[model samples]
Target chain A: MSKGKIYLIPTTLGDSPINDVLPPKTIDILSQLQHFAVENIRTTRRYIKKVIPEKDINQITFHLLNKHTSISEIRHILQSVEQGIDLGIISEAGNPCIADPGSLLTREAHRNNLQIIPLTGPSSILLALISSGMNGQNFAFNGYLPISPQERIKKLRQLEKKSQSEQQPQIFMETPYRNKQMIESIIKTCHPETLLCIATNLTLSNEFIKTAPISYWKKHIPEIHKQPCIFIIGA
Target chain B: MSKGKIYLIPTTLGDSPINDVLPPKTIDILSQLQHFAVENIRTTRRYIKKVIPEKDINQITFHLLNKHTSISEIRHILQSVEQGIDLGIISEAGNPCIADPGSLLTREAHRNNLQIIPLTGPSSILLALISSGMNGQNFAFNGYLPISPQERIKKLRQLEKKSQSEQQPQIFMETPYRNKQMIESIIKTCHPETLLCIATNLTLSNEFIKTAPISYWKKHIPEIHKQPCIFIIGA
Candidate 1:
């Protein structure tokens, strides 16, 4: 049997309609796939149902992968693909492998020489980036900061210095609930003249993207507690 | 009059069908816009025609923005938006403000406090990253390399060191025509153990993506001459 290809599918950022962020081809491909490796089975099922409602959800098989997933299990998941069963890796939010655990499976796919196809969709990182009006020509996405206050602040200083020397925007994110604390750290640790961009609730109705210096952000910080946000530190 | 939004629209990476990469909202927004800021007028006009065949192309007003465009010109283009005229920034290929000159307009819009809504679409950089099976959690896109071979090799060394130090992938690209030169430089300079990913003709019918060590690549280098490509150096 011919080896099945692995489709790297993307899910919506939030409650926004799928049509607003995804192409028609994504749904067309999802309808034919019966095996999937997903970050969250429930969310992936819901996303698939939103576009391909006719499918019998019970007929499909799901493999759950997270930070706890092991390499042996990842290889086990690909056994189906080895036998000509196609698999799709769907993330809870955004593109698989981007700020998510999808890359683990993708890496294994490369090892096995399986065809991996990545579909285009709503990526908060890319969306926040294009809207920030920062330096998009050259930028980096440093997924998340350290949880420790001191370590996080030190990392911020390092990113800020790199952004200045390279004249590039340094992009990063934080856990939703800790948005305020992240804001405070940036405001306090970075230079006053350093430009910062805070992009929150992207693709949703209440989307907000603003770029300003640390001094301006000190007095007008928004209520982004528990909101998904992307932060960029640049010139 | 209420202010109009600056729609950061995206074009296809190559000749892939519009519906294959862009969402329905993109064509909807493009149909209604009478003003556009584009990298190249001819390509943008052709793109609009492909999606909105019935619309008369002549009625739309386009402001060309490129490497040579001045900040004053970008501000002048926004005069209509200030008067509630919706404007879309279209690039020759892929998303605007990403490895394109569209950010000048986006930056000016931010300066004026205009609403900048970035629509989702194909981004070669993001697509390549997700497909690479590399560390997408932490990565950087250094848009291009120095034309001079020596400087280009030096920059490659810097990126490779940074990649090894951070355990992050350093993504970069080169002008299509000089792709072979780039591949040669990587084979000759980068460490044998270093991993490299070369994604070519992304989103097109003939897409190619592969990640392997420099030693493995030395024995088998694919023909990527004069083809749009993205390269990544990682651990």
Candidate 2:
């Protein structure tokens, strides 16, 4: 029997309408799948219900695959797929296997030689970069910066230097609750003339995406506490 | 009057059905817009018609914004938007302002303080990375490699080293026509153990996305001449 395919599904960025981010076909596919490896089972169940309310939640099986999931357990999750049972990988939000632990299962799928399909949807990282008015051709997504004050400052300086020298924008994210601290560091560590873009609550009703010189941002920092955000710095 | 918003529109990767990649709301927005800043007028026109066939081709105004477009001309394209006329930016394929010259106008939009909205859609780069089973948390998209053979080889070596040392996947593309040459260089230059993923014809009927070590790829190289492809390297 042919190995089952793995679909890399994308969820809405926040509470945005599913119609605004996901295609109808993606929904159709979601309705058909009976198994999933999700970052958070509760959130995934809620998201699936939001998209396809008619979906029988109890009919579906969820395999946990978050940061805490062990490597050995990941291999076991693919056993169903190896036996010709198609599976879907869903993240807590946005696309799976991206800055999320879904990669662990996806990597295992490859080892088992299962085909992988990625559906179209909103990607906050790409959305932020395109709207930042900065270099998009060449950019680096550093995921999250170091937590320590000194290391974060050093990393920020290094990113600023690379942005200026290579004409490449440096993109990164911070823990939502630490958004304020991240902005504080960005303003204090980077050159005044550097351009910084703060994209918060993307694709949501209260979305705020803007770019300005660091000096200007220092004078007008927006409150982004407990809000998902993506930052980009460029010269 | 409030400045008009700039919508970053996404086009199909190939001749795939629009319903497969773009949301219905995106189509509704496309149907309502009368102005667009596009990479290729002909292809953009074709895409618009495919999405909303009821749209009157003669009623819409198209502003060219490809590599050949002068910097000064990009500013002129946003004049209508500045006057409160909503505008959409479309690329030949995939998302605009990303590895595309649409950024020139997007930058101008920010300078003019126009709201920029990026609709959700397929991004081959992001799609390839998510499906590659490689490191997705931290990755760099180096748009294209150097054309010169020596420089190309050197860049490949650098990318491989980065992939192994940092576990950060390196993604880059090649001119469709030069796809074969790019693969030849990858097989001939990088270490036999280095993993390389070549994702081609994404979101299309005949899409092929796979990852394997350089040694395995050397023994079985797929024909990708004149095909749009994204290549990723990781440990």
Candidate 3:
């Protein structure tokens, strides 16, 4: 049999179905596929449940395809594709491949000359930038801040300077646990009047978008620590 | 009356609804607003008609708010918001405020402490970037290249050097008519080995994504200039 196509599906980050609007039809398309390679089987099961609330989870076959999975598993996924088995790849949130492990699969697929179809969906980074009134004409998305506090601050400083020089915006994010420290670093290191945007709980009821100079944030010291957030510093 | 919220709704670039996937709920929200500010009132009205097929065009007001519009008009838009009248703003296509006239209004809203809600929807830049299989981690979407051919080539050269030195992707596009010329310049100026991605008709049926070194584009000159495209140069 001839090889089948690859579909990169987008998943929601948290409770907001607002971003998952296309998942129902997406799942319908995946149902006809031969394999559904998901970031996490259990998580994908939960998402599939939420997307098609009336369906039974027991009917779906989800294969785990995250970082922990070995190389052999990936080869098996490729082999399935080679056998004309349609494959559906999904992330835990947003579109797959960007700052996600699924990129490796996408790269491999391209190398093998497989047909890859990317479905349209919500992206937290773009949503944050579009909503935050920053230099949208030119902006950079640096997936996540460095883990080390010192390195992260250095990166933020670089981001701020780049934005200023190019009159472009720099975008980055931090894990929930490290968000507060990231904010503190921005407050201490960035210039007083430097523009900064913090987008949190995007697409959810608790969503908040704060855009102001670094000085403004210093005054309030927002409680940003345990939230999934995106940071943008403008030049 | 309490001041109403201002929303930056994203529409598509052309006359078709295929590129537009904004939910019906967003259209309903847009229809109820007293002031609807758009990049081109005529074009926006045509797109809005596609989304809300049954709405009476006479019932809704569309304010032309392109760069040519005066500050008084913008002030009036703000005044409407201040007076508790909700307003809707849209660009010709994709999300407003990003490389669109809505940015100025958004900045003004930020300064005035008015609520600005960004609904999740189509984004031409992100759609193009993600589909290109280019470096999405570190990317800069420079709005448009210089109109003059000499300046455009110079800017491309500068962006090429910056992209190489900094290990970041640089994205820029030309107006529809000049796309062919830009492609020719990119082929001539950029090194043969440098990767170039042309994402055209994004999110539509005839959508095309071509990622190749300048060498490959030089070979396929005929097909490259066929559509409205976004040119991405990846390091």
Q: Can you list each candidate's DockQ?
A: 0.82, 0.83, 0.46
For model 2 the local lDDT of residue B117 reads 92
Comparing to the true complex, what docking class would candidate 2 get?
high
Model 1 residue pairs with clashes? none
User: What tens-digit string does per-residue lDDT give for candidate 1 at A57-142?
Assistant: 99999999888899999999998899899999998788999888888888878778787888989999998888888888899999
- B195 Cα displacement, candidate 3 (Å): 1.7
Q: Which window of ten consecutive residues has the lowest lDDT sum in model 2 chain A? A: A104-113
Candidate 1 lDDT over residue span B12-33, tens digit each: 8878988889889877888889
Evaluation by DockQ, superior candidate among 1 and 3: 1
Give the per-residue lDDT of model 3 (tens digit) for B133-220.
6665677889899988899999999988977987677888777777889988898899998878787877566777657678878888
Could you tell me how far off, in angstroms, the CA of residue B156 lies in candidate 3 after the best superposition?
A: 2.2
Error of 3 at B176 (Å): 2.0
Worst ten-residue run, lDDT, model 1 chain A?
Answer: A106-115
Error of 2 at A229 (Å): 0.5
| Tens-digit lDDT track of model 3 for A1-235 | 7898778777665787643234233546645554688887878878767766777667665778777877677777888788888888888787776766775676566557676766656678987887777866778888887888899889888888888998888898888888888888999899999988888887677878878888888888778678888888985
- Name the regions of candidate 2 deviating beyond 4 angstroms: none
lDDT string for model 2 (B1-235, tens) is 8778899898889999988989988888999999988888898888888899888999999988888998778778777788888999999778898888888887777777889998888899999999999877899899989999999999999999988887889999999999999999999999898889999999999999988899999999999999999999999
What's the TM-score of chain B for every model shown? 0.98, 0.97, 0.93
Worst 10 residues of 2 chain B by lDDT: B104-113
